[model samples]
Structures are given as C-alpha cells and as structure tokens.
Target: MYYQVVKRLFCIAALTCSGMYAQAQHTAVKEPKDVPAEWSKAYAPFRMAGDLYYVGTADLAVYLITTKAGNILINTGLAGSLPMIKRNIEALGFKFKDTKILLTMQAHYDHMGAMAAIQKMTGAKFMVDEKEEDVVKSGGATDYAIGGGVSTYQPVKIDRLLHNGDTIHLGDMNLVMLHHPGHTQGSCSFLFDTRDSSRSYRVLLANMPTIVTEKHFHEVHEYPGIAKDYAYTLQSLSGLQFDVWAAAHASQFDLAEKHHPGDAYNPAVFKDRAGFDKELAELKAKYEQKMAEEE
Candidate 1:
C-alpha cells in the first residue's frame, strides 16, 4: 500500500500505470511557453512584518530580513530579477549591497535565477542544504527531477552547507531550517520569529513541497528516496506550528487577498493557520485524486 502511494506520487504525471516500472532517465526538457508572465511582473515591495520585507515580483516571492549586522535575502526570482529586487530593497530604504546572506526556498530556476549575480554583486555567502549543493553548483544540470543535461540558471558556489534543524544566526536574527523535501531533494522551509509594535509573531516561510517529476518514483533512479522524502515532508508540514505563514509563491499564500500595494504594515494579515491547513489538505487531496485516477 505504501509503495502504491509512492508510485502514485513519485511521478504522478509522468506516465500511466501500464507505463510504470522503468527508471527515470536524465533527459532534457524543453523550455515551457506557458510560464506565467506575472513571474517577472514587478510588484511594489512592502513591509511584511518587523524587519521583514517582500521584494519579489507579483508571482515569485523574494524576502528580505534585516538585522543590525546585515540583511538576508531569500529567493532571487529570475535571472533579470536583480533590478526589481534592488529597487524594492532600496525603495524600502535599505541598501541592496548590504545583503550578507543569500538563501533559497527551492532550487528551481524561478527561485534561483539571480543567485549567482546577486552573490557576486553583494559579496554574500551562498548557503544551501548539503543534499542540494551539487544541483545548485551544477546550475540545475544535476536536477534529477528537472531532468535536463543543461543548466537552467547560472551556477553559484556554496559557502556553507545546511542540515535539517540548523539555526542560522546573524546578529539578533535566528532563522531555523526545516528540511521539507520532494519539490526538490533538498527543498526546505524556514521558521523564525519577528516582532512589530503590536506583538511578536512566529513566521513560517514554507517551500510548499510540490512534486515536479514527470516519471514514476519507482522509476526515478536519480532520486531513490523521493517517495520517503515526500512522505516525511507532508507529515512534517502537518505538524508544524506557526502563528503566521507564507509560501515560496505568492499565489500559494493568497498574497492578493491578504494585502495590496501600499497597504499598511500589518503581520496579522498573514495569521492564517486555518488557511494553511486547508492548503495543505488541498494539496494532499490533489495527489490522492491523481492516485485514484491513475488506478
């Protein structure tokens, strides 16, 4: 039953049941044409919470965490996202070059596109989960799920390796890494605390473990533990406790429904524990539906 569930998820969209029982090949995928234009669409950066800011595009989400020592930037959006990100940070009255650390939510092109350039410009150290270090360094060439013998984005060197439960401290800020694999082998979420005038809030920057493979898990020889990893990620996400939450993509967290451009600073808008649970359940149901359909 568990292997059946794993088969259902590992490559839910890869092939039909009759076509299962083969390993996933490291093949090349063509550039997709239907990519959302909103991915690169400029969004007015605004304060999300105490010292935390949203500097990404309308779809892709980039975050900035400020501290006395330096700032931490998460997710770089696209290869051309630097201009917008820089403007967003400077617009918030923060220096763009002051970024001391570069973090990633996932290793996909949309999230990691500008990492190399940004790291070069800011001279910030690029830290990634050890499990994903090779993929990032190979610039997606080593991505078993993505399955391309080519690089999707510019390669960047890793300065440090992060393991599950490691706390990254810079000045007074402490952000903990939660290994939530599946979307990518090393896909992860972040848990941290931030405060404003009202009170302190426990914030979760979730990676939203999405299964992106096109081959069956039993066949995906590149990532042997994908099935177990996805199970762990789902279970881990279900048990997490967070006062407020956001996801790697704005759409995942209903950013529009929560806040609009020029909206005043308020962290309460993100306090949607019920919504988070619903989203998680919906994702589960989606996979379950796919599983049933395939069967």
Candidate 2:
C-alpha cells in the first residue's frame, strides 16, 4: 500500500510542472476556464475526525477545523473554487460565515487564490508564516518559486504573521505550526490533537516539500538556498510524530483510497506510519536525485 501510494503521488508531482505550463501556454484567455477539469471538480465534504472536516475539491485540498468560537479554514484552492468550497462547507452543516481565521500551507497561486475573497466574505483574520507573508500579500508576485515574477490571483492582506513553534489557539483547540521550507520559503506544517469517540489522535497537516520548478536548484537566484531549505525541511519533518497525517494536496494522503463515499467514518485508515516513512524516503530520494543531476 505504501509503495503504491508513493508511486501514485510521485507521478502526480512529476506531472504538475507540465500540466501547469500547458495551462499557462495553451489557454486562450486567463480565466477560470484555464483551470483543468480535474482540479475544478467538486467533491462532497465530510468530517475526518473531531472538529476537522474536508471541505476542498476532488484535487485541491481545503480543511475546516471547527471550534466553539468559530472555524479555521485552510487552503482556499483557485480563485474560481470559492463557490464550490462554500457549498461544500455548507453541505457539511457548517456555516461559512462563521469562519474566523484563514490559514495556508504555502503561498502558491493554486493554494491561496481564493484567500482574499474568503477573508472578505467571512471577515476572517488571515494568518500565515512570516516567511510567506510577502508572497501571500503579493499573490505570488514575490514567490521564490516563480522567480519573483507576478503570478495569478488577487493579493490579500495578512492579518497576522506567525513563526515556527507558534501555537494558534481558539476555544479548546490548539495547533502548533512547524516551518517546513523549500517548497516555499514560508511553507508550513501544522500539528494538532483530534479526538474520535474514545481515542485521541495526533494529526499533522503536512506541507509538501516537492520541487515544482524546472530550473536547477542552484540557479534559482530569487531563492538561493532552495536546496539547503529542502534538506532542512526533510530533516525537520522526520523528527515530528503524528498518529494520523494529511497533506495540502489530497492525493498525497490517498484520500480517495482511505475514505470512500457512504463508508463508515474510520480514522484508522489514516494511521499509517509505514506509509509516512516511505513517503518521506521517496521525497528525499527525489530531492537528492535532482541535486545530483544539477551537479
């Protein structure tokens, strides 16, 4: 299962660059139509564990962490995905207007495109890693991944800036932020505890460390330490412990395989230590191979 998941995720990552480039090049106009059908398809939202719900699309991932005070929304997908995301949240018996905070794993266009609109509609305070604040505010214009070129999406104001080891508290929930760079200078992973009936689970929202650009690591002038950052991120992630883990991209966590439609909610499928270890190893191997090729 682990090997199969790794093969599937690696293939998805490998195709991302070509898919993105093709969309950028072949689109007649830069509109929502440019988004691939796979990414834009809507998926029914469902609860994953205590207070945590999957409110994202079939491809892009967005999560809603509920609390007595309000709710925290993570990763808004593309700018055109706002409606579908809202419907998903509402479908799950969640009030979209009650969302109090907005967070993201990274500041990429695809992940944070609808952030500004969501923040405006919910009047939520947008929070992000300090390292990602600039990129988020500029809507990927200041991203090291894009060579500092202006990218798509509307820019947003970051209401709060966070650092590594910082904890975000709301009601009875607490989430510790972990800085995992390389994918983006301010890429972050989050750790929190969620309960399922009698069992307590440590859940980690993993920020992927995949290299998305075609440029060689050393040649990335906008982010000179890309290679070093990835090395540090890989080391940092290995030390953390979690019972159940999920990633910013749904495919990374094998969402479809773990949770089928109308199936009884079982968090056990998410508890795969072997799968996690294998995934990290594969990602590290890919990074090393890229470095070797550049050398």
Q: After the best TM-score superposition of candidate 2, give how far the Cα of residue 25 lies from its true spot, in angstroms.
A: 27
Best by lDDT: 1
Clashing pairs in 2: none
Q: Lowest lDDT 10-mer window, candidate 1?
A: 20-29
How far residue 274's Cα lies from its native spot in candidate 2, in Å, is 1.7
TM-score of each: 0.87, 0.87
Instruction: Summarize candidate 2's per-residue lDDT along 65-102 as a digit string, tens digits.
Output: 99989999999998889999999999988899999989
lDDT of 1 by residue, 42-144 (tens): 9999988887899999999999999999999999998878899999999999999999999998888889988988998999999888888888877787898
Candidate 2 C-alpha error for residue 214, in Å: 0.8
